[model samples]
Target chain A: MPTTITVTVNGTTRTNEVDERLLLVQYLREVQNLTGTHIGCDTSNCGACTVHLNGKAVKSCTVFAVQADGGTVKTVEGLASNGVMHPMQAAFKEKHGLQCGFCTPGMIMTSIELLERNPNPSEAEIRRGIRGNLCRCTGYHNIVEAVKFAAAGTGGKK
Target chain B: MVTMTSAPFEYMRPKTVAEASRLLSKYGGGAKLLAGGHSLVPLMKLRLASPQALIDLSGVGELKGINSSASGLSIGAMTTYHELESSVEVQRAAPLLADAASQVADAQVRNFGTIGGAVSHSDPSADLPAVVLALDAVMKTATQRAGRDIPVERFFKDFLTTALRQNEVLTRIEVPKLPANTGTSYIKQSNKASHYAVVGVAAVITLGADGVCERARVAITGAGPYAVRAKRTERMLVGKKLAPNVIRNAAKRAGAEISGSFNEDVHASAGYREAMTQVFAERAITAAVANAR
Candidate 1:
């Protein structure tokens, strides 16, 4: 049976009819037309579907849309304000944090959440923070550097 | 891409432990208890398990939090790994728990995955089962009618199986407090991508005066049907001094202790897991010895 759920996304309230099995990633991409939350690995191994669920970063692919009902969600697209990208996003671009940007959105979103909880993480902590997210292109050197860059700028916040 | 999603099941989000237990008892093998769904959801997506109903435990408030008393630490079944990993009380009382919890799937998974669910699921490759076994923890379970506590040694029945009855729900895990001068370590060889341990070993040892081992409890994961205590290794280490040769001998004994077949999945082979188990046993015991000082 389809369930009626109301969720707040990107600062906008949305009420939609969704199947019980519909994943949050699908709801974001198909229903809301928010493609910024990419689904890299449906098995939850790839962190490409990372998004903020009530201010904590989680793989949207692992969460059912109904499970997210009444919760606040923040996708990669929601991080920007008025036209400015989040500091983590800007840091990724400035530090060459992408070769094939498929994993960049999830990486940036996850890093944003990590820094929120821990503003100044050591190099080892940064690596441990993103251990769930996989990036095959850049070998994570630039991603680590990007997080560091953002941490130095605004102490890893917006 | 393969379709990775749970099969059609009657999902009921019961608001109380009594309600969930009633559903579990009525559904028999057709119902599964869903705590964080970290273990069950993945298997459901893979079609390995197709229960007719899922009793969601997330809404049950009684199964959450870490409660401590003079007897020991009692962690609710719904207490997420994130809670255990970051809890100041856990870090202070059972620091090894925080270490083990920190290495589970990842931040996102840990945020939802619960300690009771992990131990109850009985994944041999998981990090917590061995740690709990080494700590001599007790698992508490309840049905609508009754409740009971099972020791960790008897809690894990076999691979992907636990002593929890079909109608019973795991409610809490009790880990006893170690005496002063006790040290513990958890060493795991994780699959870099999945974060599941390829081979994990946890050791808790107490040192007497002159650095002789007074008590040793060693448990190993990812090398057998279930995480098991290295009885031979533990027996050999007691009353022995913390020396390189003694630790190496005990570690070797731990490697030889496993006689059953191992998981032959793509992550590892039987031989490779055995070898890594020995390596981790050595590392964990050595680290525990150092920490004892």
Candidate 2:
């Protein structure tokens, strides 16, 4: 029997019927239609399905929707407020942090959390922080620059 | 969407260790303990493990903490890799352990996976087993029948198998404090894509007066069916001077002592893994010796 789980996504609370085995990525993309969180690999190898579960970044593909019941989830789509890009998103755009953009959402999400923890991270720390997220298009030179750019900006709004 | 393809099993979330043990005792082999489910979930997705019941230990409060004591350090079974990596206690007592924990699968896997789950799962490629063996830690297991402590060497029995019997739950891991002037290092060659260790070597060495080796403990992972101690290399180094020549020779023996073939998955070949094992052993020993000094 499927369980009804109530979750707060992108500042909206919604109740949905989720199978015990349904992954959180599918729930976000299919049911909630928040396709910003991409699923690059069904296995946990790819960080394309990254999201903030209770303010912590996690690969949604590895987590069951039911496991996130009653938790607050922030998807890539939630980063923008009033149609304005978040600082990390704007930094990526300004610095050309992405090329293919398939891995951009996850990369941005993970970087946002990383910056939150350590605002003035060094180049090596930034690389280590985003080591889990893989980018195929851009060689990550711009991404590192984007994180530094975002870190220097005072206003959260980009 | 990846859904559970196996037969439906009874799921019980136990709030306490006693409740979990009771469920395990009742279900016995039919029950499987669910920690973070990072290791077991993937197996179940492929229909590898189909237990009739699952006892979820996520709610267990007793099995979660990283604290130090007069004896040594005690890490709760439910401590996640993220917790270990950021723990001040772990960083102070055994920095190598924190380093190994940081190298686990990835950020996501480390956040969800528990240290106890990794140790109990006994995956040959998992990093903590090698660290545990090198630290000479003790595993505490509890059951409805009784509770006992098993040395890390004997805790792992075979491939994907542990010394834990049916209804037994691994409760805590007790890591002994290193003697004075001791240093440890862990080095591994990880597959870039999966981030699983292809071959990992961890060494703990204590330097005696006059720069002689007082004691040596070495362990290797991802090289065979289970993590094995480099007993021969350890014996050769003890009582010897801590010099590059001795370290190189002992490291060579350590690599040579690792017998049997490693699992040749999509990651790497048996030959490449064997070669990497030797290289990693040398580097790990050299680094550990420097730290000991």
Candidate 3:
């Protein structure tokens, strides 16, 4: 049965009727048209579907849309404001953190959570922080550098 | 990308533990109690689990948070790995639990995966089972019939199975505080792909004033069908000095003590798991002893 869910996404309150089994990532992509939350691997291993549920990063594919009812969601689309990139996004671009760019959104989302936890994570902490996220390109070196850049820019207090 | 979705099911969010248990009892085998959904959701997407109804426990406030009593720490069943890892009480009272929870999967999964869900799911390769087993934590559950407390040893029955009845909901886990002069450690050899432990060991030791072993508890996971107590190993160390040679000889008995066939997968062969079990056990016990002093 389809159920009605009221969720706050990207600072906007929206209500929609979604199927009971519709995944949070699918709802974000298809219903809200928030395609920035990529679904790289439906199995939840790829971490490309990472998003903030109630202010914490979680695999969107592993969560049913109904599960997010009355909760808040933040996607990569919500990161920037007023046509300006967030510091993390700017750092990614500045550091060339992405290669093919498929994993960038999830990487940035996961990295945002990582930075929130540890504002100035060492290279080793950065590697362990993103163990759930996978990037087949860029060898993760640039991503590590991008996180470092963001940490330095923000004084590690994100 | 694989567009896998769970099979359609009715979903209900109950507000209280009693309501959740009643719903579970009413639906019987058709209902699945949803916690953090890390384990169930993935299985559902894979079509391995297709419950007709899902009793969403997210709305049940009764099953959340961490509390400490003289008996020990009482962690609500829905408490997430993130909460466990960041909790000062957990770190102080059960550092091995914090160590194990911190190493589960990644930040995203840890943010949502609940300890109750993980323990109930009883994944052979999971980190908590071994740690809790070593800590002698007690599991509390509620059902239409009654509420019960299950020790860690009797709680886990087999691969991916627990002693939980069909209509029961695991309410919380009660872990006792370690005694003075105690030290604990949990270490795992993870399969890089999934981060599931290939061989994980958790050790807790209490030393007498003289520094001889007053008590020792050791548990191993991933190298067996379920986390099992390293009885022979514990027996060896309980009253001994825990010297380097004593630890090495006791660690070797961990692999030999398991009676069943080891889990063999692409990540590791039986022989490799057997070898790693001893290696991890030795490291975990040694680290625990060092921490004890």
**Residue pair clashes in candidate 1:** none
* Error of model 3, residue B113, in angstroms: 0.4
lDDT of 3 by residue, B193-293 (tens): 78889999999999998889999999999998988899998998888898999999999988766755788988898988999989999999999999999
Put down candidate 1 lDDT per residue, A112-137, tens digits, no spaces: 87888789899999999998898968
TM-score winner between candidates 1 and 2: 1
Q: How much does each candidate deviate from the true structure in C-alpha RMSD?
A: 2.0, 2.3, 1.4
Candidate 3 chain A has its poorest 10 consecutive residues by lDDT at: A130-139
- CAPRI band for model 2: acceptable
Query: Candidate 2 on B1-293: residue-level lDDT in tens?
Result: 44554455666678877788889878868888988878887676567888887687877888999889878889999999989998999998888889899988877677788889998999989899999999999999887667899999899888889999877889999998899889899999887876778899999999986888899999999988788898888988999886788877777766555566566777887777777777888899889989988
Off by over 4 Å in 2: A154-158, B1-10
* Model 3: per-residue Cα lDDT over A10-109, one tens digit each: 9999999989999999999999999999988788898999999999998999999999999999999999999999999999999999999999999999
DockQ of all candidate complexes? 0.49, 0.42, 0.73
- Which candidate do you rate higher for lDDT, 1 or 3? 3
Clashing pairs in 3: A119-A156
Considering only chain B, report the TM-score of each candidate against the true chain B.
Answer: 0.96, 0.95, 0.97
The collision pairs in model 2 are: none
| C-alpha TM-scores of all predictions | 0.95, 0.94, 0.98
Best by lDDT: 3
